[model samples]
Target chain A: MPSPSSTKPKVSALGSFIVIVWLMVLAVAAFLATVVPEIDTLLGRSHLDRTVISAAQAAIAITTVVLLILALSIMKEVYIGRKLR
Target chain B: MLQAITVVLYGAIVSAVSFFAVYFLVPVMIKRLVASGHVVQDYHKPDKPKVPRPAGPALMAGIAASEIILYILTLDSSVLAILFTTAIAFVVGLVDDRKVMPGWFKPGALLLAAIPIIVLGAHPDHLNLIFGRVFIPLLYIPLVFIVIPIAGNTINSIDVLNGVASGFLIIATIPLLVSIAIFGNQDTFLAALPLLFTTLAFYKYHKFPSRIFPGDSGTVLLGALFGALAVAGSSEIIGVIVLLPAVMNSFLFLASVKKIIEHRQVKARPVTLLGDFRLAASKDKSAPITLVRLILADGPLGEREIGIQIFKLAVFAAIMALASIGIQYYFLKDVIR
Candidate 1:
């Protein structure tokens, strides 16, 4: 098996992108939890409104899954087989 | 006063039985499994030693026997549910150890294990976070299903190095046990004591230059039990924070791989070997990202040294978990109460 270069691994552009996106997703989740509830109330919705809660829940879930897919596609070839020269 | 004494006696008895069970049963399993040609090459060692594979049955026997004694002394449905979940995970892993199942086998099968907790109704709909408690309500049921598979796999992913799984497990378990005590859940504390004793005992042979491997059965079973205990104790967030290192390892691997697959099935080795047998980070961009690979990013290190680094990371995460307890206190006046 070909060996990896014995050097420090500088953060890849992809790594930075993943980190940034992950933080953004977390921020979005927080927004949904704190801000989105207030938004619902402003719109004449009660605190127990299932519609508002599930909508935020769906948004968070979809955002997370989409980011995961993007990460996989970015690193797909790199992860599966060693493209050693 | 009499009840206190009996509780102490039960704790001592359960621990002793658990310790002895693994201490004795392991050697027998080693002899039997090695004799049956079930040994695998210890590729990480310089000499490439052959070690008996997957002594999970012995560990499970120790745990099950200890749990049975506890139930006999104090019948707790939560205790039985945890035991059943862990045993199911063990069987899921045992199948993989004995035969090559498809990659989906372990994860798919472990979902069944979570059913016991749901069926026992041991988990509440409320989750305690660092800031405050949140009521997941109906979502907690789905969370159980997600947690079991993730827990089983996350711990299994960290079993890459000798003694890493058991040692990390022992380190990670302390906070949970502490939380249980703080909550004054004495019955649950007694139930959890044997788990600690069994894993601690297994480490005697499971440390560097391991005499035997925990295999899938051991890792998955241990992981499942860890998760179950977290749910049963209502300390899921604490458990996750304490296990952040292992959880990070699992996430890095899964995110890199883009799918559910076993480490055994991977073609690209994450860490490559140097002439001295120390593992160096693979410059191969194609290599799967892993905790060990990231650890070696600066340079190659000895296997035992790498194990120490991982343990240190776990300890650091555990301290963070402890800090979160303070956060919980700050948010909720009666945190444990």
Candidate 2:
């Protein structure tokens, strides 16, 4: 016979987890924004072909996407996966 | 000073028009909907009240009228692009509201909403990262197509509780407006006004103990408008960052369900109602995981509290979004320069 107000709201772990995921995603974005351009510059100085530089940039973009997917998977695992187990 | 005064004048007029349009129309739409027997049960409520639904037409009217006025005043094609994109999404949502379409229908159909933006050349060729911009002329076209559907569906998916969708939109749009004001032009910022004010108006009826649900039509329209504004304003990165909570909600549901299926098709719900009308996270492993469920993970809570929790997450995401902009402006100034 517990009334609705009888239960106090507890701080959610999921909230913290979401913030962690956001930071990870932001880190990845920062890496792309800063590090990738520097890598392009270094590659250009090495006299890499235009297509080679483009390919290298594309690889980083793909890696960024993959890293994001990994981050999401980790979130899923930590919250849903652990609960199911 | 004259120019600033004119801008303020137009902003005030458009805001008033958008806000009042929905404010007045929703009550009428509610009566009409209920008369036509278009109502849905509010399961979260203990008594299960049947709230009139599909407030889409009224919402569209409010947004369209305000945008058209702004367009006539400013002659901005970007305004037309947003208007058309939102209209198309409204139609698609209205269709789904009338018929039980496949889960893919809304997302797939929403892809068409991107057409207006693309054909009008409303988006920029470069993608704006926080620190700098990347020219993606070829990739930008496909990105436009992908982004509209994702944005439309993200808001739609998050509309599980009363007022969560509209309230989320209100909070989420803050960072977008800030970003647009900072990095984008005035035309796009003016174009985004209706979205903010219309939702503000509709939220009066859509909030806790909702008298009228926005239905699929209303949610999709707001979502599509958000997507359109982001692209047209070239604030795509900020837009995505602010929507992390809704995006995460969509991701969790899809991952748990392992498919693009309608939520109604799922037998096990992520949340269950207690006898006292509080919501508890479902213990059934088969149930799909959702943001609301996660919010209730610690214990059962009233619907209003859960909605507030989601808003808190959105506010946090907005702060992070602002931080991202700060990083670009302050920390990475040299690189961007």
Q: For this target, which candidate reaches the highest TM-score against the unseen true structure? A: 2
TM-score of structure candidate 2: 0.94
Q: Write the per-residue lDDT of candidate 1 for residues B1-337, one digit (tens) a residue.
A: 1278887898899999998999999989999989999899988787889999898999999999998888887878888988899999999999988898887888899999999999998777776655555556677898899889889988899999889999999999888887666543667778788778899999998999899999999999999988888888877777777777787688778877778888878898899878777788788776788878877766777788778888877777667677666655566566455
Docking class of 1: incorrect
Candidate 2 lDDT, tens digit per residue, B105-147? 9999999999999998888887777767777776689989989
The iRMS of model 1 comes to 7.5
Q: Which residue pairs in candidate 2 have backbone atoms (N, alpha carbon, C) closer than 3 angstroms, thus clashing?
A: none
TM, every model:
0.84, 0.94
Candidate 2 chain B, which ten residues in sequence have the lowest lDDT sum? B328-337
Report the CA-based lDDT of candidate 1 relative to the real structure.
Answer: 0.78
Per-residue lDDT of candidate 1, residues A10-85 (tens digit): 3243244334433443344344345544544564555557666666655654566577556644553353233222
- Evaluated at residue B134, the lDDT of candidate 1 is 56
